[model samples]
Target chain A: DAGITQSPRHKVTETGTPVTLRCHQTENHRYMYWYRQDPGHGLRLIHYSYGVKDTDKGEVSDGYSVSRSKTEDFLLTLESATSSQTSVYFCAIRGLGEAFFGQGTRLTVV
Target chain B: QQPVQSPQAVILREGEDAVINCSSSKALYSVHWYRQKHGEAPVFLMILLKGGEQKGHEKISASFNEKKQQSSLYLTASQLSYSGTYFCGTEVQGNTPLVFGKGTRLSVIA
Candidate 1:
């Protein structure tokens, strides 16, 4: 198994609230990615970080933001949560050959 | 862009074999494979780089075709432990986040 962990394994927030999910890794990998998995859409990228303080937006970046202040930590935030944002969020770390994912956080915005 | 996977669902008996295919319209530099059990994290499977490379872990194997912009995952002599959802992720440019397909659900029964 990979040395990656995700905080708030499960969460429930009301609409218009703020929520933050954290991903921590002990492998010191250079690339980190945040993705959301829904019923029909599968998994879509939200944001990714290649290095400390260096991040990029993915296809579904709207309504989501990320920060990587350190190599081992990557954070995803929903500034103002909405029902549409309710989904399972996953974090992945990449290496030379393949990438490993965290356990995932199940978020439901009611 | 997201990759498209074939056979939304599949059922197999122990000691059987299965194949999952992924196709993308965007130019692909690499292809990755992952498997996620129900309500669990997706474990890293393999990555096929450009120039028709192949790589895998365990009993799984994969191949990439840069010209066709496609990839296929082959599972030989599948076991009941192989029951899960298979996902194919494509890395377009180097350092770019991987875009995943909808995924194929495979159930290996006894």
Candidate 2:
């Protein structure tokens, strides 16, 4: 129900190709996060941004990069797609006490 | 680190009760609960801060134990709508991103 949106809700890319997923929010939240969900792995943090141009790596930041040039937009990019990187990616923005998530983007790399 | 959730999966009849527990090895600043259907974004359920508080939403309730670095979620008189995967996320401090547990899949049968 939050004002969060993810672009390219579903995507399929060939291996070694670069892919980027976009997360946009209208809540003006200061904290934005990118997470990936696999079948057995509930959710793993990929990267997060606290403010414009301020970003940090998470537990599974390998092969991924993030940029937050504006407060409402956060981008997650896979330098080179791989089958192992196929997963559902979610974007979340921290609100009063809880975080609001987007509809999620399902990406497939073959 | 990710929290450890008990009972990887659960099955309950309509109007029955069930409980899901989440434990962490590191200290917790807060515990967050979320639920996701088969293929959708996770929906925020509740958040328990460091004060070791208990909160409820409808028939769903959760308790946080700061001392034990754990949290528990209780679903009373469960309904079919409750059939989903429940995840517990732990935050080490304010403004910090969460580390989520391997979710518990709940199936409610009529």
Candidate 3:
């Protein structure tokens, strides 16, 4: 893991409940991304923020939302958790070269 | 679109060599390689820009071919630490988020 941190390293939630995962970075990088990793799917981008208060949807943004109030924090929210959303979520900060990832948050929706 | 990775799984003996390939249907501006161990986050390996150049990361090296929209990761003298899932992420262009392949799981046995 790089300078990025994801809170709630592990969580078990119920379907239909709301959940939010937080990613904090000390790198002060301009690009922050939220991704979910599942078996056979590798990692799929959920959303990304280029700068503070600037966010955009990713390839698999449906059923997910993101907010970037500050350059150091990016939050991913699942309005209503679904079983399909259970996976390991990772946050990455892109530097001039490669993207550094957080330890990851494993969320289980039961 | 997500890139396609070949040989979804591989078994290699320590000190052996392995190659993982990633190909994209769309034009590629850059390619990023990352490795994720079981229960860990993905760590950056290397990045190759559109120049289709080859870059090295320790015993691992990568080559990108922009014209073919593909990238290959080469592991020389594989070590036990190299046993992990390798993912290739592609950026269609600058300022765009990456789309990852399904990943290639490498098992380096002693």
Candidate 4:
């Protein structure tokens, strides 16, 4: 696993509230990505960071933002929570061979 | 854009075989495969690079058709441990992150 952890393993929030999920990795890999997993919908990337301060949007980036100020940490923020925004968030670090994922954060918007 | 995966779900008996396919709308630099067990984080299975000249992890294998903009995963002699959701993610423009497909769930029964 190489020391990958996601904070607040599970969270329940109300609609319209701002939320931030954190991903930390001990690995010095250069690539970090954030994705959401929902039933019937596989893992869809929301955003990714190639390097410090170098970020890009993925297939589903709306209503979400990301920041990677350090090599080992990436943060994903939801501007305002909505029912449709509820899903399991996973963070991954990529290496030459394969990618490793964090445990995941389960968020529910009610 | 997210690559689309075929056969949203599948079922197999122990010792049987299964094939999951992933296709992209545009030329892909690489295609990645991963499997996630229920309530667990996704673990990388393999990635096929541009030129369709890559294969990864003997236990789980995949092939990429650069010209066809597609990739397929092969599971031979399936095991009970292989029961999970399999996803295919594609990277465009080379040296970038990925956009994943909806996923294909495989259940191996005894």
Q: By TM-score, rank the candidates, best first.
A: 2, 3, 1, 4
Instruction: Give the alpha carbon lDDT tens digit for every residue of B28-108 in model 4.
Output: 888889899999998888778877775756556788988999898988889999999999988886657777899999999
> Could you tell me how far off, in angstroms, the CA of residue A78 lies in candidate 2 after the best superposition?
0.4
The worst-scoring run of ten residues by lDDT in candidate 4 chain B lies at B51-60
Residue A11 local lDDT, model 3: 98
- Candidate of highest lDDT: 2
Task: Please report how far candidate 3 places residue B35 from its true position, in Å.
Answer: 0.7
Order candidates by lDDT, high to low.
Answer: 2, 3, 1, 4
How much is B85 displaced in model 3, in angstroms?
0.6
What is candidate 4's lDDT per residue for A6-81, written digit by digit as tens? 9989999999999999999888989999999888878888999889999999879999999999999999999999
Candidate 2 chain A, run of 10 with poorest lDDT: A92-101
Q: After TM-score superposition, what is the CA distance of residue B63 in candidate 2 from its true location, in Å?
A: 0.7
Ranking by DockQ: 2, 3, 1, 4
The 10 consecutive residues of candidate 1 chain A with the worst lDDT sum are: A94-103
| Alpha-carbon runs more than 4 Å astray in model 1 | none
TM-score for each candidate, following the candidate numbering? 0.95, 0.98, 0.97, 0.93
Give the per-residue lDDT digits (tens) of candidate 3, residues B15-99: 9999999999999889999999999888889999988799998999999998999899999999999999999999988868989
The candidate that wins on DockQ is 2
How high is the lDDT of residue A94 in model 1? 82
Reference interface contacts recovered per candidate: 0.89, 0.92, 0.92, 0.92
> How far in Å is the alpha carbon of B35 misplaced in model 4?
0.7
The per-residue C-alpha lDDT of model 3 at residue A22 equals 98
Q: How far is candidate 1 from the true structure (C-alpha RMSD, Å)?
A: 1.3
Go through the candidates in order and give the C-alpha RMSD of each one to the true structure. Answer: 1.3, 0.8, 1.1, 1.6
